[model samples]
Target chain A: MSSDGCSSPSGPRAAVGDRVVPGPGRAPAGTRQPLVRFDSVWKTYRTGAEPVHALRGVSVSVMPGEYISIIGPSGSGKSTFMHILGCLDTPTSGRYSLAGTDVSSMGEVELAEVRNRRIGFVFQQFHLLARLSAWRNVELPLIYAGVPRHERRVRAMAALEQVGLANRVEHRPNQLSGGQQQRVAVARALVTEPDLLLADEPTGNLDSRSSADVLAMLDELHRSGRTIVLITHEPDVAQAAERVKRFRDGRFIDDGGEGR
Target chain B: MSWWETMRSGFDAILGHRLRSGLTVLGILIGIAAVILTVGLGEGATAQVNSAINSLGTNLLIVSPGSSSTGLVRGGFGTASTLTYANALALGNKRDCPDVAAVAPQVQTGGNLVAGTTNWSTQVIGSTPNWLQVRGRSMAIGSFFTASQVKTDANVVVLGSTTAQELGLFNPVGQTIEVGTVPFTVIGVLKSAGTSSSSTNQDDMAVVPVTTAQELLTGTPTVSNIYLEATSASTMGAAGTEVTDELLALHGITDPANQDFTITSQTSLVQTASSVNSALTFLLAGIAAISLLVGGIGVMNIMLVSVTERVREIGLRKALGATPAMVRRQFLVEASVLGLTGGIGGAALGLVAAVVVPHFVSNQIAISVPATLGSVAVAMVIGVVFGVYPASRAARLAPIEALRSE
Candidate 1:
């Protein structure tokens, strides 16, 4: 099944998997704004004499609580999309906003606050600091959010429990298996209760079994009403998502429509 | 994070490379310790000079005769015999010299002092009864000769502690000591006065009435020195002028330049002693400043290396929501910790050296609280100033580029 961006009068629920429940569903885009929007966004890197465009004229929308996958090979702008979406980088041209707030023109201090309060990130490398234990790593985003230490610990422990790593709270990243490390990363991303969760090649370094386990965990999080953007190149990994958007060069192939 | 938490992490980062951190601290430590020790040494020298001047008695002046030349050979000062004992008495009159509080005129001679079978060579000084008060000396045994003793030219002597000890007299009072051909009874022993500026020991000479010494000992009425104590500290200049004028008039030298005497105040003596030590202190302080600069450079070098090595870590922290200011603060804390440790360690080491060094060296090592505290403060500043460049470098790192760095 495919749901194009223009055909999203489906209360934003028809765009996801089959766990849709009957409730006071979300208003249409005509009434409520999309959680994330990108209009003709561009990203360029000036490494030497010439400028390199990592993202070019890309446009998309992600409704609240929608679990979406962005699939593209290396140099296909998927990483750039995740970076811009997470407020880690600003667009060179065009406009990009999260939850109706424009962040492209934000200063470093403001951008850091946005990243801390509004976005959660999980990297392919499982970028957990080696010096910290699982709970300490999970509590990092909350630390930036200025949460009290006691509350940060409690919420971090709760996040670890949700990821089924409560027993490994004090264990360091090196002490855990690859799948456990990815799970810990997932816990860290969810600890801040962010508006958006971005996972960049989260299973890229995991074995097949670990990859499937992480995907299943992400599927569970999606069902429980968490917004997630999974960036990857593997078709099988993209298959785990209810909706997928493909990218080529710096623009989205699914600009106006979506297909599998 | 709270400041304490941030500082703890900074401390952890510094500790990650123990040997490098320690070497950097050592550089600063050496500088701080040297400054403290040098300051103490300079202070000790100043204190020694002040005490030496103080021992000469406050607001006092000494008038010594000009050197006498004999066939191109000039005798030392006080050998001219230009000042007579009568000149001393004339100056001592309150009506003639109102500013002059007291005067002690003495005739000095060296002889083998004989007490029984024991004999010791010492300078025998002949002075009036006012000599004890004028020289700020007190008697340890019996008492000094009275004005009556000087009036009768009594054959009495007051032996110095060292001279009496040399002559093997435990209680020399009432004992007999022969000075040249004269036999004098020791009426008292003078309290020890240690040593002056040179090899002459003040505690190693004997004192007798000027009349007794002049009539039976030197057989001369000339005075070698006239020690004048002004009525008060403020009247020393007035007393000096009065003495010079009176001496010139008495010696029949109308021109002031041809006067046969020289007056040196205790203030001048103090100034001469301090000038030499001041030069040494200045050189030592200069060296200390250079060492501090070198130490500051060492701190900068180590901090730069730390910033470079932790690029990825910095990126991670930035991504986790650390602002540039927070990152800079972290590095600054690390740098300051290094400096503070060095300062505290150096101060402790300097204090220890101050206590221990005096045992081996003849010079006193004065411990100064302000100097110690000031050195530590300077060490802290050195750390902070040197830390700025590296900390700013760390703060400027872009999160994306830093994270992507291998």
Candidate 2:
């Protein structure tokens, strides 16, 4: 009787699954609304007088608790799509909304605010500041958001605990293992408690074991009703998400068999 | 983040690159220090010169012979040969020039003064008791020759402090010093007068009666120079004119342009010295300002490099929702802090230089606190003025471009 309703503790561990049920602490059904919406977005880059289209006129909508993946080849615009969704760049032409508010026409300051409040990003490179410790890195977004000192520490520590990185909070990125660093990056992204989490190739640099561990954490987060959109070129990584959209030459080749 | 947090983070980043930051600050430090030291030294020299000038009494005048041309060949014009002992008697008898307090007619002869084994080259000046009042001098021991001594042509002399020291005359009041083989008893020892108002040598001289000087040294009834003291500064112009007319009539020179003597007052000397000092100070300050300009360039160059290096950090902060103003403020704070710190250090360095250089060379030089403060202010101004462009560049960077730069 979980929210997603495909229950039976079937993925990796049924014993540990029974201990922590999926969607057990989530909001009731029909309470949360769609937070991110994309409508016929197109992104084109001009190189030497020749325009290269990166994203065709494609549209998709993501609800509050959906875990979706955009999978593609190397030049298939998956990264471009992630950049647009993360508000790091605006679409060349089209409407994009977060929490039903149109963000396509927003200025740089407004866009930055949207990025801070609505979308948290986790990059494959784990861009935790090299000089700062895990806790300080987690505090970066809050610092930008102008959170006071005492509250920033409290929230950053809470985020680290949620990623199981509480013990490694004081360690710098260079001092931590790859898995530990990725976890710290995740904690940083989650510290702001944004409405959507956009991760680009979260496990691209990890080993099989570390990849599995990362995937399991993503699955757990998805089940907890935290919306996650992951971009990757690997089918195995795409399969970890509940829905997958395959992109080819700036267009969706298939919406992963219609999410069925 | 709060502005304090941003500033703290920026400072921490700078601290992380210790060697580079130190090198950059060192350029500014040198620039500031150079400015301070140069200006300070100039100010100290000016003060010393002013003090030395002031040490000579202000109410005095010197009359020297003016240059004259005879058929385009410049030569010393012989004038007023008859205004000798007769004119001195006439000046002492005048009542119209009441400010004429004292007048000393001098005839000088330069030769070696011998005292036992000590043979010192010195000048012998012939004058009466009024020479002390005219020349503004005081005796450390004994007394100058009286009017009767000059009238009688007594073979007595007064030694200058330096001349006395060289002759080893511990009790020079009763000692006999030989001037050009003519033995003369020392009547007085002049006190130490460091330097005259015109920076002339006053220490190496001997004083004797005008008649004795004419008989023993020059063997001529002629005088070279005359020292005059006015009763009050208010009547100096009148006194100078009276003395000039009297000398002109006595010498039978009717043409004013053909006058032989030049008369100068203490006011003119002080005025000329002040103007010259002001010009020299301006020249020195201008040179020191060039160092501040160079320091400003250094600050600008370092700030530009810092902006480039911190591009990614700027992008990251922008992505996290920092405004352009915030980014600009952070860099500006860093630059201004560099300037202010360098200014303080430069001020301290300049003050130290001001203090030490004068001590080693002489104690006459003095550096004031206002000069040090001025240099520090200039350093800070240079910092802010040059720091703006780089800070703006860093702030205006597009987050997308900066983030993808890596």
Candidate 3:
């Protein structure tokens, strides 16, 4: 099933800005069971005209505590993979298991539980509720997890502190900079302590400085044994992870990131 | 999510769009207030009808001469001299009309009362001494004339309180008063029955003996009205029938429809008045229902827009693990909150208008607890009903597609 092309990782990418924190190296993927596994996943969407194959027979696995990035241009299935990884969408034909639980054919309610307990997502648009303060935004996931108010506050504060946004807890989205907003989103994702953190174009809307800052923040998270799956179109942003997997036309071109 | 959290978030969502939410609330406000006012007015009208009928005394019926047709032109009831004092006396006989307790025959005329040179034009009614008992009237001063007074054609007049006041007489028993150039001694004054909604003044007439009125004034045997009191309240219908049969027999009309007089009962009068009142109330209530429907549509329209505008927010919430039920509840709660706020505001406004409007309008606005509370409940139900589509629409959205939408 291997592509048998160049199994070499790309040469070190050019830095877009000054990187504050060094990325922790990849965890050895062969020793323990993978936290996420996708077996021949396929997603087909039907419209008035032709059925679009957003993902076609893509197979991959993400080991626990490993940081990985999927790189692809627009319409190259990377975003689809991120959606499937976050349990926001299900594969039309495939087995998708998160933490050894098969969730591919689960109902919407079960998917929601998985998304709440097992997956956390950072969107390209930051997706912070415009009306809520930073801490309020961070505590949202725990709210859905049925956490009590006092405990939700405590965990949300800890998540924000981990993201180095402890001081801007009361500031709303509009009051904070784009980097701070994205960091607050990351804190929200982290507050649930999910098994997988899926980031879809996390720095897409930011300038180079902010992008570097968010990347460094992600790097610090990865160093602390958090499993992260980052989707990106830029080579430099993809380089923030220890491993990079390229995708095109709904198929992942394994550049030897899948250890045999 | 807990209901408290859902509710807090729903309230927060409404507060986020104050102007839009307020405008939506205003629609329901006007609808609820209009409904309340119309209901109050209808009840007030019914109450007025009831009180007016009750003031006419219980178990009584009036027999009036039917319309007369002369050369193709017909007059209204009481226009023909078909009723007489003999018919009234016959009704009072227990063998002829067993249900009839007491009968008063009266012939009325608009005449001037002159006492101490202060002249007042008022109705002069000629009736028997039983008029007071039949009409449920009591004397405020002096004594009513006796049966011997009617037999002797005595010119003794009993003034109503308003007539006595207008004619400059206080305690004018044994006083002299001129009834259209015929001098009469005032024997008593009737207590007032107070002002009513009808144009007829109940306390502005004078009563005298029928014999004296006919001899001294009309020179006619026809009487205007024959008031009959039933033996008991339960026999009112029987009493009315007895009076009609007696009058028809007395007039020598064999066919019931060809009778020359008409019997009027308080029950029929109240029924007719209240029917008209209820029809008006129904019309007003229909108008209010339309407004309420429009208000419900307004809530739906705003909720649809909210679902559309916050598509991304909804997706984000779903991605954060909110169930479809949770999303639906949130929107429904928001709609109910709007409806409840508007309901409270409208109820307050309507109750205030009830208190303050009676001073300006002639009719009282009765306070109705059921209508008030029922309308508020209806508003909330309207919110929930209209919210269903929009809330489910928000709930049915696929999280990925919603998040991807701009």
Candidate 4:
């Protein structure tokens, strides 16, 4: 993993509009570029007799190990932005690259491979299959990755341990509490060792205590040098990230906030 | 996913909805059972016909009067009185028809048999002493009439077992019976031959001398038919041809199509019976196949509903990195398993029915192995063919749209 703005735990954060320089690391120059780069991406939906512009010329970049939050009310294009970032939908125009590979024009099969190997998504609904246990849910991505069964089980157990759900590996999603289900989803997201973690309203269905626990888990992951992108409408959730980007009417607006 | 894992998931899905899956299987089961029963009864009928024909006599040939055409309308077999005792005599000449072993000339007429106070209508067959040899029959009491009796035109007769029984005479030899007011003495009794495959009772007639039948009963020299037995089964074909040629020469018939006589071998009779049986079998199978088609549609309908109900699950799997091909494979395997299971169950049921039916019905039920195997294969094909559209529909679902479904 590469270190950027989030390397120092107690130092004063860089001001807004300041470019994040590479921190002291052993990575070569070729690998120190931003992990995510989107140059004026656009998305248009034509579902209901007219074209709906879900995204319009949105441009952004994020360095490695940075925790960025995209906050917007409903119908503000935040979900569309998360979809594009998670590789679930393709951008209509402009360049979108992840880990140096341009993915804007990729086909469905290639995009699926990218989502399986490079990106992990945490949806608001948890999305755990009701039939499978927590460990089996975590093992799903590795199963698609063609990993051996024994090794997939081992890595799934390790991920469950990371989310503090080590004792609940055999419990199904319905048997677990809302906070525990969210933790299982997190473990599932991390099991593939993806380069980017995309959390979309991770605390939307949880109580305050579970939401606090989930936010604290994301903060810990960011501190441990993982790239995290959080999408939420809650101010407290946005405050946990090092930077916040505001959106309204299908375009990004200036939130004007530095790391706190 | 590995093939083992795919199969496991498919079986689990089938097991999850027990009632739905069972009903689907039942449809296929009924189809397969119908196929088995139809084929089994057809095969049994064919075997019964074959055995009946075989029991008549392996190397016997029957020479009957051929059709007679009058302008546009033509008559069927035994319509023309072309066969005669002269033809039998000429065929019996070993130097002329070396393939023939024995010959019997028959003259048949129906009349009431009178014995004391009992009276019954029965066919009286007039033949020579060689009738028993050519027909592969034996006397159960007393002895067969000698050739001397036929030559002398004696009024002695041999009674069939059923004829004797109906006359209330267990020991009918030397007893006198009236045939159209002519009293004839019974000399022997033939053993019962049971009912033929064509459903004709072969034991309800009496035998007499052809000479007596012609001069006294019918007052004509014409005989109804002639039966010839070959020296061996292998010579039956040649014996039939020889009889045809000899009869045509004796009648001075030059054109082959205008022949006065028809010579038929036992093998040809068996062949005709089996061909008719096979045609009936095909007709029955065609009717049964309609049910199989309906069963396939049932599978398709159920699978389509399953796909619709599990749209969100499909989306979840896709988002979890499952390929479209994998989704299709899982559903296809599930449908095939249902078909195969139903096929096995139906075959077992059909076999049990075949075994148990003989006690209640006279029709034989034969379970042919090839037909059973063929039904099983067709059932599996039905499943795979019907499953394609539903599985492809599931595979084509968009991940985002499917996940959006509740």
Candidate 5:
């Protein structure tokens, strides 16, 4: 049912959904450097007087154009892991790198630049600004990137088209359905063409049909030689990935094997 | 992002909350309006007083008797009769004082005037034919009493516009009116001179020959005051000094301070009026400026509330690659727009008040250009000054924490 072993091993190959043809197969982890690296990362939260250890000495790595899922129940540090990987939050201690850049020790400004250029985040809530139109929401990242007005509009429209929402460009969030809103958010994330697409429960708030649609879109993105790291507790959602890492009580219990 | 786009987005944010922004702007509007209105009214009052002082007489001087002190029981100026027609004649001599233009000696007293069944209380001023020339007055009807009429002590008088109106005589020339139980023929009616800078009505007196007043009305030969005009405004100081010296020599008073006669010039009167008006203007404007400070505080309060309310928006923007500086610029621009709108609206309101207020008040109210400009500038400054704390607070917010604020 899944199109496994079809991701391109080379840098940024074009992907046309089911029509996409596989390139030279990726090398094994032992023979190549990874695009994402985490060395014994720990995340602690000081809510009040006592500290809660969210992530305890966890380590993981991801390669380019690889689809992976990090699955865990609530309080298993899965969300914290996604936050650190997206550069939204830093580790309490230990080194982390993305696209060969050390991001663990970066300041807020530098991290923000790294997040803008290298990462695209899709949240469970869809996080589309309610006031802006669908295309305007998609154009937001380009605006921050200092893209000129005409080019930002063109690229935003193109990205919306990629998500099959070309006719809903002028629709506001409230005017669109849940699945369409998620698609618009996906378009927003894709507009920047970042190296990593980190989705934290991208379909958690949608109905069964909408959730299926979002999951299928993510699978299609993975088939198109795009990197996707989806965080979810649903087995059905995680099963779509080629590989999976299971987390329990802030520790990874199972690192699924790679396959071709 | 570019500064233009940042400003545009900030304006959009401000527009999103119209009622809140409007109320905030109203506070600043009242403040700026108060400042502009007060300044306009003050300027108008000062201008009115200055023109009134100018119309009193051109380069004229009034020499009146100083106070008489009887063992510290002092009597006010104009209470003694040290000035006389002889001193006036001496001052008017061309060889003695070429700077002196015209001289009109006068003795004044308040009395009742009766014509037919109408009666009015008015000031009766005794003077010569040169009264019109020295006082800068013009005859509206017949001529003034000639020199021969003054020497003969003719019972002829010239009625001022107000006095004529009071006596119910529009054309008073050749009409008879009783002054102190003696019938006097009105030879002329003086044109309206309006009011003085001191706010006293100038056209409420009747003028008669000085000899007629001394011999027939007051029954005394002692004159009370002398009016002298300089040939040119530039020569007033020299003319004043010459008149004082001539009076002192005539009266045999050596010390200048102890001289019984005192000389007051038009220039001094104008200077005094201007200084007093300027002080009043500053006081009024100062009181009005306090409201502007309060308006600034209002702006700061609104901005702080806005920053607190938009924490999530701030987080979203920060996540989208906006720098802390960019965030600060956005809020600052929003605050400035609020202030600019309020300032311009208030200035327009003040301009309307400047035009409309004169209809209600006795004095003219005028909008001063500098004050209008300054009020706008002050509003802008208040915006920036109050906007900083809130903008900095928004800029310093951590993205993760702010996003979690819901």
Candidate 6:
């Protein structure tokens, strides 16, 4: 056992080769439990009778107010990992704790509660209800969270305002520009003030200019103490995050030789 | 949000597709109208029949000379003439039959009623004072003939409204009207009793004393029919039975089958007519219900298409934290809106049909608004019932998969 609480670089921490270690200097200032933790998580899907392992013995931890990026190629299990972190799917064999609660053992209803109350998801498609106005789309999370009508309206409006979409609140997805629509999605994600904001290729469908705009907004959200986990196949998008974990063949590979 | 707001939001969604919603509602409207119109026509016809029967007389029985089956196949009068003056008198004298209010013998004869230059063919009936009370016919102008006039074979006469109008006798009270060659004085004119299309003779009729009618026309004292009145409405059936038994005994007939005269009551005739009307109404309603079923099926089909089209919307809502119940409620609200709007339109159409059709075809047709409302309610139920499956299917869709779809 080590005398200090921090694991030594030459000790058992070195045995797990190529695993990015957390830097001692980057430890959170305040004492708070990790918002997300995955222990020996294994996810398998049956393509016909043969089981294909998507994630094998993957362990990870995410603290509050941390901006992380998950980078991978096609079929590298990054999407599956995003699904697990967003509470949209449970790991087949692992203890997955979210917001200090072991969600791997939670029932469907509890998982839905977690998804509703703690996790906000943004998809590459912008996933805004096409029939609803930007404001109504943002209010969707509050509706799920059972927020009162007046407060929900206020919070949704404020979220839209935060995303600088105050004037486009009444515009539907088709009526708004691609960048504006993504901002509306962002507003929706932040409306409930969830513990985690998960974005998966959020700017994949946007042009470079719109992509930079969305990336800047994400960066601002990170600086404002929002915990964001974004997934992307592009290195430029991943570089915008404080930390990037590269996934390949169901395993994490360190590229910059830095801690998580 | 309040439940009302939720409902209102659902309503807004339904209204968003105005044309589709209107078309779906049209199906329900037609269904409700069919049910209401069919039921209304049947009920109206029944009411007309009952009124027609009652117009004949309250205590009157139509004793045709033959039985229905015998007349239908044999094409002649059946074997039985138990109806006589003596039988009428015996029924009137029965102490045990308190229901026997009065009895009057009647004989019908067709003749030309002539007054001055006007001449009209009319049915001349010979009846006593009891006929007026039993038949529910009273003198509108002059008084009906007294019992003495019937016994003495006097030439007093009463004229029906049509008969008086045809003869150009506006107020010919105490005026003599010649029937064939016999001169009879019209002592009274009857009030207008509306005639049914089924029976044309009801409008054209004349009444005279029984003896005078027998002596002038048939040249015999025998009567053709007997009209009887019950003491009260409640004892009509008892009165009919007593009159039948007394007539049978007086004619020395042992078997009821052997008797000639038919004893009928207004209550029985009215009851029979009402039952027939009920059956007709059921048949009409049944036929209409088939159309309603088709309309309901149309609603279901449209709703299914709507659900499929709105799959993406449903998915996004679910992804945003809408429970399955909320999704179901939204669809249900949409369906109910369709049904409700359709019901209103159908009811309006039916009302127009009820009002307009009667004027063009006949004035007797009646439309009941409550019946229309009932149909509307039924249409709404059909909409809800048909909408459930499609709504549930939309609600049960997986949020992620739905959102992923284009």
Output the worst ten-in-a-row residue range by lDDT, candidate 4 chain A: A6-15
User: How many Å off is the CA of A67 in candidate 2?
Assistant: 2.7
Stretches of candidate 5 off by over 4 Å are A1-33, A40-58, A91-93, A233-235, A248-253, A257-260, B94-99, B110-122, B137-198, B203-205, B222-224, B230-239, B254-257
Clashing pairs in 2: A143-B1, A144-B1
Residue B3 of model 5 has an lDDT of 86
Clashing pairs in 3: none
Segments of candidate 4 deviating more than 4 angstroms: A1-31, A46-50, A161-170, A223-225, A255-260, B66-76, B79-82, B98-101, B106-198, B201-224, B230-241, B248-261
Candidate 1 — which pairs collide?
Answer: none
Model 4's chain B TM-score?
0.85
User: Order of all candidates by TM-score, from best down to worst?
Assistant: 3, 6, 1, 5, 2, 4
B220-311: candidate 4 lDDT, tens digit per residue: 88899898899998988888788888887898878778776788888899999999999999999998899888888888998999999889
lDDT of 6 by residue, B1-114 (tens): 346656776677777778877777777888888877887788778778878887877656555444423444533353444355655666778595678787777787788888
Candidate 6 positional error at B38, Å? 1.9
Runs off by more than 4 Å, candidate 3: A1-27, A256-260, B67-76, B139-148, B168-175, B185-188
Which pairs of residues collide in candidate 4? none
Report the C-alpha lDDT of model 5 over A128-190, residue by residue, as the tens digit.
777789999999888888899999999999999999999999999999999999999899999
**TM match of model 3 to true structure:** 0.91
Error of 2 at B368 (Å): 4.0
Candidate 2 lDDT: 0.76
The TM-score each candidate achieves on chain A is: 0.87, 0.86, 0.87, 0.88, 0.87, 0.88
Off by over 4 Å in 6: A1-30, A250-260, B67-82, B195-203, B220-222, B363-373
**Can you list the residue pairs that collide in candidate 5?**
none
TM-score of chain B of 1: 0.92
Top-TM-score candidate index: 3
Model 4 residue B268 distance off true place after TM-score fit, in angstroms:
4.3
Residues B1-406, model 2: lDDT tens digits = 5668866876876677778766666767777777666656556566656656554455666666665545666556444333364555455545744667777878878978888888898888998888877776789899999989988999899988988888888888988878889899998899877774335567768999999998888877767766677878988898888878876776678987777677788778767876786787677767667767777788788889988987887887777777787888777777776777788887777677766776566543356677777767776677778889988998899876787677
